[model samples]
Target: MSGPGSAVLAQLLAQSAGQGADLLALRAIAEEAGDLAAGRALARLGLEDAQAAKDMAELRELLAAWRAAKKSLWKAVLGWIVKMALVLMLAGLAVKLRLWELLE
Candidate 1:
């Protein structure tokens, strides 16, 4: 026996990749694989139709969150760089105005 759990999972994945396997089929495969693997199941549990949709929803949510976080981080970095540039430009302007004397 080559581990029925893995064999079933592989078959499920293969079936899922095929053109004919729709969402319902994929959920069926998941449920069957979960049943066969029992305690050793590698994926999500639950056989409800909504369960698969929930998984997809959660994945989308995570992706959206990651994108938002990435955008925020870039914006923060850009803001810091702009702030630094403004400060430097103001300092240069002040020096040129002779408001602050530079001692060499």
Candidate 2:
């Protein structure tokens, strides 16, 4: 429809899969129909669909790296805690056995 009063854009989208609908053609139709709002909507919808179809592998990889970093950080903290505990236990044993006096 080439008139504002003609076919509504929302109705068209609801009725069809928008497979054959071209953004440029839709804009032209909306312009000729004096409906800039519909033209903008059509362009926005087309761009959104285009972006959604793009590959997201980089996003997935970044998420994986973040998860790995979080895991590694926790492991390092736990490792440090274990090492400190062992050192403290060894010192306690030396004090209980009076090993420092023997060193003198």
**What are the RMSD figures for all models against the true structure?**
10.5, 11.0
Tens-place lDDT per residue, model 2, 1-104, is 54664557646644444677766676676567656675677678663344543535666788999999999999999999999999999999999999999999
Model 2, poorest ten-residue lDDT window?
Answer: 47-56
Q: Top lDDT: which candidate number? A: 1
TM-score of each: 0.48, 0.50
Report, for all candidates in order, the number of backbone clashes.
0, 0
Off by over 4 Å in 1: 1-50, 101-104
The local lDDT score (0 to 100) that residue 52 gets in candidate 2 is 45
Q: Model 2 Cα displacement at 8 (Å)? A: 27
Task: Give the Cα-based TM-score of candidate 2 against the true structure.
Answer: 0.50
